[model samples]
Target: MAVSHYTLPSAKLDKPAKLLIVAAPFYREIADDLIAGAKAEIEAAGATYELIEVPGALEVPSAIGIAERMSNFDGYVALGCVIRGETTHYETVCNDSSRGITLLGLQGLCIGNGILTVENEEQAIVRADPQQMNKGGGAAAAALHLIALARKWGGARKGVGFLPEAEELRIAGELKDNPTA
Candidate 1:
């Protein structure tokens, strides 16, 4: 299989913006690295964050829901590691957690899903290291991107809106036709 590559845009996060992190302790080794990377990124962005540890990936959604409702955080990050075994449990956990995180983001919450679903420990190792693949850092970057997009579009205090570049150009064209009218 070919290796998949991705790049994230660099954006400055709003300083002092509240952040909440929910991590799974089931895969302690990998989880630790992920948390470390995410924390470092959040701090580098000049934001303050709190971490809540859950038993495993399955419990992450409830923890996130509680934190989101309790604190006025601008964004949330969910970190976990699930390596597939010879059982169907892996599929359930991975799918449910992903769906839960997506729902949270859709509910006007900025969430960075750092959950790593890999085929084995080796894959997890590659993605969890702060200095290596850095999936955790990637999650933090995604959170910052969503936060910036939210601010530019408008806060959740108001409903989300979309104004495409082409739409802006069309409006400008109409305005120019009127001139001083």
Candidate 2:
């Protein structure tokens, strides 16, 4: 029932980061507003971003997944609007797109999901407005937080095979113990 949530300030980063915004422009105006807010948020966080358009909400996640595999972005923002009409297609779009984004996040990719699933255009407009609910900015903020978390825990190690150097040492040790030696 509530779209407004408490936002945490973005963490200060020692270095600049690059981000990708994979947006679905299904509702041109709505998507535009969402993208605006997301851009503003990313700028405020001092991160550079690239914007790419997909055909629909479902494709937004797929695009980010591809970028995660092939690109060097530190995080991603997914933007789209899925308005409910007189059909069950609404639920499918909303649920499946959201699930796809979640799965990507679980795979260690920092993603901000700003897709709006609403009963009507009015609700989407209200939520997408930068001066109102600002869901797009919220999503951007979420991604930034996750990126900070990733950076905080990055570097240093706990296990063998985690690094190539450690793996090679382990292989050498195994070879040393071989009976043929």
Candidate 3:
């Protein structure tokens, strides 16, 4: 397997941020690990978070939307695991969930997607560990990163100032690597 490394950005925790976590219970084991990892990162960043369970991956987007509409959370983390099956149902769920989450981000809601789209259980196990470069934590990091950027950009607007070329390239790579909704 190819090795990959990520440098976590320093979290400015002068004021704790409120976070909402929407998790799918269908894949309980994997989802649990992802949640645990996210919780760890949230605490480490000096933030408070709440976890809300949903029936499955398909429900994550709606839950996030409702939470965003009703609550005052600074960000959201969506956690789920979707493993490939005999039919094309996996593809549909993956694509729709990803698109929905991406839309949420564009709508100015900070969302961290820890949803795992994999071929089997082994891959899920490897990626869910808190100490093993958790994608869950990575998602949380991305959310925080975006939140910081949004603030620096002075809230939502039709157009924004130019991002450093290197930073833009880095974000593009991250989005391509994990296309979750």
TM-score of each: 0.81, 0.83, 0.80
Candidate 3 Cα outliers beyond 4 Å, as residue runs: 1-3, 155-181
Q: Could you list the CA RMSD of all candidates, in the order they appear? A: 8.0, 5.3, 11.0
What is candidate 2's lDDT per residue for 39-119, written digit by digit as tens? 999999899999999999999888987887677888899999999989899999999999999988877888889999999
> What's the best-to-worst order under TM-score?
2, 1, 3
TM-score of predicted structure 3:
0.80
Candidate 1 Cα misplacement greater than 4 A, ranges: 1-4, 158-181
Q: Specify the highest-lDDT model's number.
A: 2
After TM-score superposition, the amount by which residue 44's alpha carbon in candidate 2 deviates from its true location, in angstroms, is 0.8
Lowest-sum lDDT 10-residue window in model 1 = 158-167
lDDT of 1: 0.83
What is the C-alpha lDDT profile of model 3 across 1-181, one tens digit per residue?
A: 9997768675664457888888896877778788888888888888889989998888898888887767777888988989999999999999989888988887788888888999998998889877775877877777676666666667453222355565566667855664452
Which pairs clash in model 3? 98-181, 101-181
C-alpha lDDT of candidate 3 relative to the true structure: 0.80
Report the lDDT tens digits of candidate 1 across residue range 1-181.
9998868656665545777888997889999999999998888788878888998898887777777766677888889999999999999999999998888788777889999999999999899999998888778878877887888787575222344555556656865654443
Global lDDT of each candidate = 0.83, 0.86, 0.80
